[model samples]
Target: MSERMTTATGTRDFLLPDLGEGLSEAEIVEWRVAVGDVVTVDQTVVEVETAKAVVDVPCPYAGRVVALHGAAGEVRPVGQPLITIASLEGGGDDPHATYREEERAGSGNVLIGYGTGHGGSGRRRRRPRLALAAEPTAATADPTPAATATPTTGGATGADGGARTAPLVISPIVRRLARERGLDLAALHGTGPGGVIRRADVEAASAAPAAKLAAVPDSPAAHVGLAPAADGDVVIPLTGIRKAIADKLSRSRREIPEVTIWVDVDATGLLATRAAINAATPDAPVSILALLARICLSGLRRYPQLNAHVDTEGQRIVQSAGVHLGIAAQTDRGLVVPVLRDAQQLTTRELAATLAETTAAARAGTLPPARLTGGTFTLNNYGVFGVDGSTPIINHPEAALLGVGRIVDKPWVVDGQLAVRKVTQLSLTFDHRVCDGGVAGGFLRHVADCVEQPALLVANV
Candidate 1:
């Protein structure tokens, strides 16, 4: 970040626009242009990581780069000037113009919410933009080990102790890291330009010898030992997607009064149906998940109460018109739920295709923010991890989550005779605020009935 500079051509500063909901900051992963390079409108200027995924931010104005504000690897806050571009010699160019104005008239692309293309943009209503802070913003540089700065009630005091001023810290992730590690932010000196504290600065301080040895050894032998610390004693700092997941789960647990009800269903018919479908159409086969997804839709239609969210703000249960089915997907980035819009309308084969494509995108870290949101209900098949049953926490703001356990052969009574059957456990965790145990149990029983007899879904299909 830097002061808005103006010259003969009038330099227009481009601030980092808000990427998604609740994303206040992003890390500058890489810059596409250097100082003096010519840039065009809609051309990607930089790539940034904002807890969710890495996104390429496009320039809305074509100009010559006068100066770059933040460097690579530095986290910058939304509405902070990322680059200073000398306005081109044209009548439309205005040094005082903001990114929002240009984006509305030129690109017309809405970054979030309902829009045109599946993975792209469409025309959107103009939203109020955050006004620029009246000051010369500090530039963020690479991080280095330094003395931690002391936390003050107000901003940092000037070197002469004249006036209280704000520190050059921008990212909340940095604050979270410091807070979790109990590191003194005021004690650590910043390596960024204008004393901006980068994430690396907090990380280095967290790993500092003094900080690591803050805990005293329990025994003299432990103190004298040269062996590595125990696994349980190691500190694992939460960051990026992992941190987002932790925050969401914590909020769900704290806010939602949820109750889980599970039933072990004989999935023999469901398994048989999947096998027949796959064998009949080997070229475009259906999966067990697709079959189960269809059955879940049927149950949701019967008990519409389950396909809803507890809107605490509105003090009402918002029942959705269409089901936005969220499939819990596990990837290297962590567990993420990719939602399928109007999932109740999709055929089993279509669901299989969507699931495959969405899963691939999640694994490759290319899933857009639009694809990761608006989940009315979540289906967590944790059975892939080899678990029998789990009390799943409902996805925050969403009322219910269904957990499916591994489908394995088990002893069961079939028509009064004991026999080996394909069995799986189905757990439904719903928000008590939205529905009672009776409603939840009925929904679970419907799903179990479908699993036990695949014909139960024929009417709906």
Candidate 2:
């Protein structure tokens, strides 16, 4: 349905602007203005959360808000009218009309598709009504009620076994939540207005059986022929960053023919170098991850093939000119890979500072969307989890991901003699479509070589 509501007055509808980088919708976290409040151009009126990050949406036109569309916590699609504003008393001309005029003149002050001489609200066409259907006569007619009676399409499985109806829901995030949990939208009753299913409902439905089972006595399991859970289980619904990670990983597994290759590296030299650097520059301490990142950058420079992505749609392998290195950081919002743009150019100290800043921002959920994307390769330091190694799935759309494991002391043959040294496992998972084993092996070897001798990076630099 058209989100715009109009009257005889000079009114302008401020539709939600496209937040760019494939963001289709956002949840209204809060509204800065209410109805009847006067707002200026470029004034942020709402804070919204996309699948990726939280963003503030600014209204483009200056006027008195005649109406506000969505409330806090409501997810609204892009191009939907966020607020309707009317011209001031005796202003005469509609701001929308002025915007359209400027749009025709090729003004660039507008959001991507709004008032920028592009498209307008493109609503889905309604299916034609059956001709034999009885038309409402004057006494029986009720247009408003009839329009309100229209059914909405929503989630995955329906209540009717084979018959599917559109799930009555508005938020994609909610739909994603239900779909992930395998909950049937039609089977559940909605508590929202107009019988719309919501996130809370899906979460409750998913948690219901677990909660009931938890409440059941252990003695009854034998009578009921059910095995009792050894440990109490908690069903945490995937949302926000957790959900995003799940979706990306699932897609990566499905689409990318990934192969993991690992090598044990004697990181005795790398650790000593890091310690020496920190000792000399206590104020600007270098992290182990930074040194490893520097090593990865050097490796990427030698084998640029692994430092690129495959565009399956275009059937092309796009090699990035410079490494936009993605550092995998586990934050409160789950795992996020924040990219350091043009990392190939940054010195070890600069890389350490940037890595620290980005990691801090990611953990704080304050990193910008730009910093969270466009990675040619990912460096995952799962060593923080104290694991020896893992066959990690690649961060989708990227050609490869390098995993670093915990550095531990292990006995090894050094100079043909038994010796203990700091050792770490390095795993590289690469997309098979972009390169073969030869290229992947070489890249992994380069990284391992650097770890074994930190001076390798200095020579490459």
Candidate 3:
């Protein structure tokens, strides 16, 4: 998606390439290069936040920056002009032919499935969509009957597209915005280059409807979108991670017929096991989370059904060959599940190291996009928050999420005698379509068994 184009001039417009497949938009977190500064090919020019992680986008052209399109915190669609670079000296109108070999061959940067060629657009990029969105901000709120052009799917969603051949709509955010405002995309004229429909076009079409909503102030629908905030109400624009979390959770709840099952376990044994292992290797002491993660892998081995996701389109329950365990990390941005790939192949000590590494990276918001996705199963330790239990939502597409609650001293009857035991609650929320209560219960029970009796866990390992 990162394409650049040159005109019959000595300049190249570097468009923001597709950061990841299925991700259509990203917020400009920071810009590394300023106008007039020279930059090398593949040098990071800007950091963008796309749903899950912040990505550093590199400019593929070697030249001086001529123009910077957007600012920090601005959410822009992919393929838009990010930076305009004045090509290296003696460059003709066709920058690709005269530019360095890498410009024609590939970008040589890691941008998901891109960078192997497809660096420059090779043609003039469209007049940017952002400027259009800004120009008609006031003109879009008009209240005339002419205001309803809608951009519907076979086209965008939660991750900024993440469909309309049915039209000139490119950004899913534009499509969703059109749909929300009840505008017909076919009726509205696109002001963008080559007549592509931008978000501004949709907003312009919604002017009449917005004015109508203002007239009928009592309707619940009136308060949506650009509704005026009531006195004392704080408005937080839902974008970035918060919007992503909302869309994902809402979709998970709507599409997944999920169920929850829980059990109380004597976690005293689990703590003891960690203590003993720590005493032996104090320098590399295993964390409680790593122990739980090891046990989850064991449970997944025994009940693979819970480790699979439902391909709703194919109506198939596909089980993964290897475990890409997602650790539900609570970060300043929001809850992001940083994945530990091939967890099944790693030893408990290895898992401990990897888990610590990923969790820290997730918190710091430095993880690459690849490290933040493709999870088959998830382990959520809400226990860290000092909570006892939760019916956690299944991380969408993944069949189940295992929740571990606070381990506290609770009176229990061990060996038929009442005694205080360090106990914890374990819960599993799984996609029922993948497996019924039986598979879910088995996986949850296996985890609890490992927590209560580490001997079973040790034996398996």
lDDT of each: 0.72, 0.72, 0.74
If scored against the real structure, what TM-score would every candidate get?
A: 0.69, 0.68, 0.72
Error of 2 at 307 (Å): 1.2
Q: Write the per-residue lDDT of candidate 2 for residues 1-461, one digit (tens) a residue.
A: 22243667778887877766677777776576777776554445666776677665655555688788887656788898888987666445544335334333333332322333243333221211111112211222112223322453323343354545655654444544555555655567788777777677877888887533212123221212122354864445454456678889999999999999999999999989999999999999999999989988888888889988888889899999999999988764467899999998999999999999989777655666777888999999999999999999898899999999999999999999999999999999999988999999999998898889888878997
Supply candidate 3's per-residue lDDT for 258.
91
**Model 1 lDDT per residue over 230-257, tens place:** 7846545455577789999999999999
Instruction: Provide the RMSD of all predictions against the true structure, rounded to 1 decimal.
Output: 13.7, 15.0, 15.5
- Could you tell me the C-alpha RMSD of candidate 1 in Å? 13.7
The TM-score, computed over Cα atoms with residue i paired to residue i, of candidate 2 is 0.68
How far out, in Å, is residue 160 in model 1? Answer: 57
Instruction: Kindly state the number of residue pairs that clash in model 3.
Output: 20
RMSD (Cα, Å) of candidate 2? 15.0
Residue 319 of model 3 has an lDDT of 94
lDDT of 1: 0.72
Give the winner by lDDT: 1 or 3.
3
Sort all candidates by lDDT, best to worst. 3, 1, 2
